[model samples]
Target chain A: NAGVTQTPKFRILKIGQSMTLQCAQDMNHNYMYWYRQDPGMGLKLIYYSVGAGITDKGEVPNGYNVSRSTTEDFPLRLELAAPSQTSVYFCASSGPGSNQPQHFGDGTRLSIL
Target chain B: TQLLEQSPQFLSIQEGENLTVYCNSSSVFSSLQWYRQEPGEGPVLLVTVVTGGEVKKLKRLTFQFGDARKDSSLHITAAQPGDTGLYLCAGGPGYSTLTFGKGTMLLVSP
Candidate 1:
């Protein structure tokens, strides 16, 4: 069903480089989120959007930015990639209800050297 | 910060054995979800429990929500090798964000 799709499955960047991770969903959900998973640590929210043109910072928002230009797309931007930014990034989408289960994308493995 | 604590960070058992995973939190949540993730893949939702003291069964898997909605449990009966994966529990406060547990890595060897 291609619920949630994320581009750039893997990437490597030098310190101070920049890149954008793409995410798109076909579920027509109203909420989208960006999260990073580090070794042994649980997923941490980076940014989220309620709907198109509505975005907000999450728990760990530093070094990352997100934009929700449409209901189907929410992209995450890295301004100046650092070693700490190396982690697996995941994109998730949910329906209108706040308690609805979130559908996650496969994730993007990012490496900063 | 609201946190979900999962017990037994790792589990390895033979096939046909039963196992249980627990997720606990001090803060109450409106709903909780269990997800199973394989290597190199995102987590897939296994089940969601909302009401307190609610029990939902999916085939050989059982999900239970605590009476106070602050804890949950996932029990697998006669687990098979296919069930081996990383299990995560997330609590939702009826909003956009969810607090996730570190996860339980299960290995059911055949």
Candidate 2:
């Protein structure tokens, strides 16, 4: 169904390097989110966008930035990659509602060396 | 920030056996969601409970929301190898954001 799509399934970046994670959805959902998952830790929200041109920071937003220039795309940027930022990045989207179910992409496995 | 705690961080059981995992929180939530994640994939939503004291079943899986909206449980009847995965619970505070639990890793061996 191509519900949610993420590019660069795996990537390795050197310390101090920068990169951007791409995420797109075809469901036309209004809510989009970026999360990072560590080994035992659960998914921690980095940022979220309610709609195009509107975004907000989540619980853990340090060292990461997100932009929602279009309704179908939300990209996360890491200005300077750090080892602590190594994680599995997940992108999710949900319809317009207070508690709608989120559909997630496979994920982007990122590593900082 | 609200936190959800999932009990039995790891579980291993034989096929045909039953198991139950718990998700608890001290803060009340407007809704709760259950998701299952595999080895290399993102979580897939299983169910969402919005009302207090509500129960929902999906074939072999049963989900229950606490009367106070601060706790929930997932029971698997006769688990199979295919059911092995990480189970996670997330709490929604009537907004777009959600607080997630660490998760419970389940292994069902045949």
| TM-score between candidate 2 and the true structure | 0.98
Q: Identify the leading candidate in terms of lDDT.
A: 2
Question: Alpha-carbon error at A7 in model 2, in Å?
Answer: 0.8
Can you tell me which runs of candidate 2 are displaced by over 4 Å?
none
Model 2: pairs clashing at backbone N, Cα or C within 3 Å: none
Candidate 1 lDDT, tens digit per residue, A1-113? 99999999999999999999999999999999999999778789999998999999889999998888899999999998999999999999998654788999999999999
Alpha carbon lDDT of each predicted model: 0.94, 0.95
* CAPRI quality level assigned to candidate 1 from its DockQ score: medium
Q: Please list the Cα RMSD from the true structure of every candidate, rounded to 1 decimal place.
A: 0.9, 0.8
Residue B65's C-alpha lDDT in candidate 2? Answer: 98
In candidate 1, list every pair of residues with a backbone clash. none
lDDT of 2 at B102: 99
Residue lDDT tens for model 2, A1-109: 8999999999999999999999999999989999999989999999999999999999889999999999999999999899999999999999865488999999999
